[model samples]
Target chain A: MSLMDKMLALDQRIIFALMFIALAFPILSPVILPMNIQQYSRDSFEFADSIPSGSVVLIEGGLGAATYPQGGPGLEVQIVHLLSKDIKLVFFSIGTETAAWTVTAIDNALAKLPSGVAAENGVNWVHMGYVPGGESGVAAFANDIRSVKTEDHFGTPIGQIPLMSDINKASDFAALFWWGGSEGSIPFGIRQIVTPFGVPMTGMCTTNEVPNYTPYINSGQMIGIIGGVRGSAEYEYLMGMPGLALGQAMATNFGGLLWALLVVLGNVLYFVARREGGAK
Target chain B: MQIPMILTAVIGLLMIIEFFFPMPASVTSLNVTLRSFVTIISATALILGTIVLTIFHTKKVGTRGSEWYYSIVYVVAFVVTAGLGVLNVRDTTFLWIYNNMTSPIGAALYSLTAFYITSAAYRVLRARNWNAAVLLVCALVVLLMLIPIGAILFPPVVPLGEWIRSFPSGAGFRGMIIGTSLGIMGLGVRVFMGRQKEHLGIREERRDSE
Candidate 1:
């Protein structure tokens, strides 16, 4: 076979192997790719930074294991940043399956934070567990927060949590930060939680879903956004603290470049082989 | 008459009712219990899915398919992971396999989409139609905007990219959101009201026989 034909006929496993190598290389070596650093990331950090030390910030954990590597790192950084500012966090998951994951994410994040700056569970932060219903739950929370969640994730009553006691309604929160994969819940949060009460909201979402949330940001429904791992890296950079997000973003960019090259080469081979076959 | 379908319809009706009026304390408690039940059911579904995957591979291996080696790799990975998880081995061989082998492999697998996208874009841009040409141009613009070289070549491309992302494209996406929400609401209502009765998958078979 001609070179082009050989390339065109390459086994799928070979391609998978190449991809494996390309993705693993940057992650193992740890190279930080230079990014444009979108305003969304910067804005999210600024929103977190601008909140008063004792102000209540709601961190909505709406993701599951499927999105851990991509969305989780950004959340970890945001949680750390929020804690650094001495912000009081009210953690909750709207989707039922996400509650346990949310609590685990909080615990993982708190464990990573510096000893003194880390949020103290039940005091500095409280998880309100999973609330059933989507928009209805948000509306209920807006009207009477106590009605939606009586118990925290660990079965501690919200009444007992000092940080949650004063947050009787949506208006009490300085800002609401939602971290989730692509789901209707974020928009539900925007409409029922933020729009009606005029509470500012921000979102951290998968890269694929960032564009969907952009209009909410532009329309002033969402104050800011952090898109995927790259956005997380930008947040880490803005905070002057680098973590797993930075590594993941670098790996992603490197992977993107490698993939682009392979595509070009594959196409060139495809066209050349087609032409040769046609001639034969 | 399947237990699962009957339960689903009954539970769905209750959820819909809960939305319309202030439910009694017992009704609300039932709803919460139902939510937990759904969660457990979904978890079981995951196991069922894994079982299906194993059966598919077993068939392939038993039949001596062309990619039997790959099937073997997958089964080994699955068995090892499941074994570790079940045995509660924190730093077991399977955990290492997952952290070292699976995680990176999965990441790499997804990352390969970047290359496919580039090739797809090239082919798409080469199309002769005006709409296709416009799409191709928009894609190229977006692609260039994503990369650093585009900004270095044309500084305004970054803002231009942001504008494209935030304005025209954003409008389309918002339209999609509105459309999807309406669709989901319609589907939910239909399912709750028992208007759409394909839940059992037996209706088609009955129709075919008739």
Candidate 2:
């Protein structure tokens, strides 16, 4: 076999090894790569910034373990940004497996807060945990949030929570921030809250779901989107705080480059092999 | 059959009215109650699914087939996890299992996709035709634009990628959403009319020859 044939038929195990190196090297030795801030990421950051201090925002943590690597860091960074601005937040989920993730993100974000800033549950923030019934539950929650969530995630009565007293419905929220790993929660925000109540919304989605939510951004339905790993890196940059998302920036760049190179090399080798075969 | 159909129609109609119309407090209260009922039903369905899963795996373990060891593992894991969860006996043990074992295993499974995608892209993404060639170029451009190194090296590719995503990809996605929404609307209408009762597990009883 010629060089082109060998290249085309390169062992997959070799490719896997290369991919492993590409992902692991940067992760082990972190690189602070320059991230070009996309409009969507900037928009998302600005929206979070624009929220008036003391106003409440509903954060939907609609992601699970499967999408944790893609969406978790961004969620934590967004939480940090929200808490830093002193905007009270209510974290809830339509994704059933999101409660543990919400707790971890809240803990991580609170731990990283600037000096003298502290987060007190039922005062500054409240977690309503995972609400069942998917879209219908979302609709009901939007209509009368307090009614749907009579108790906080910790089983504290909503009436007892100071923050809960201020938020009666979806309209009371300054903005709706949905950190979704899958495409499940975006439409609910649009249909249930934004369209009906005219609330400003922002979506933080895994990189793959960016396109699905982009049209909504274009249509002004979503104020902005924190798209994928790159978007998360940009968000951390804008906040002047580096976290897991920013740390993974180099790995993302390296892995992406490796894949792009393989695509080019694979095509090149295919053509070369084809030409050689035709000539014979 | 008739009772269920009538009940579904009433509830569906009420929801629709509650959504579009400015109904009174009485009707709105009923709407909220109905929504809560749906949530409760969904929660119960989850429990039912877990029970079904446990039974299925238990039966597999009892059969002692070639893959029965995996079934035993599943059954053990489920029983232990469920017991720990119900008891809330050892919070640290539960969290440790979740954070260390479950989360890492789930993340590892998700990460494996990267290797598979790279391998698949190399072997499968061919430019045999003009359309395929365009797709290949578009994909490469988008990939390059998504990465930080690509943006730093060739800045123009960033806008090009955004444009591609915004127009071509966005338009395609919009079309799909429209198509899907229409189909869902049709299905909703059928369900409301009791034509799609089977979807709700209300299948017609058929007498069997056996």
Task: Rate residue A140 of model 1 by lDDT.
Answer: 59
For model 1, residues B137-209, the per-residue Cα lDDT tens digits are 5654565566544555557767887888888888988898789889988987776556666876778889999
CA RMSD per model (angstroms): 6.0, 2.4
Q: Determine the TM-score of chain B of model 2.
A: 0.89
- Badly placed stretches (over 4 Å) of model 1 are A1-37, A55-73, A90-115, A125-175, A181-200, A242-280, B1-13, B55-80, B87-97, B203-210
Query: Pairing residues by index, what is the TM-score of model 2?
Result: 0.94
Query: How far in Å is the alpha carbon of A267 misplaced in model 2?
Result: 1.2
**Winning candidate number (lDDT):** 2
In model 1, which residue pairs have backbone atoms overlapping below 3 Å?
A: A259-B115
TM-score of chain B of each: 0.82, 0.89
Candidate 2 — what's its lDDT?
0.82
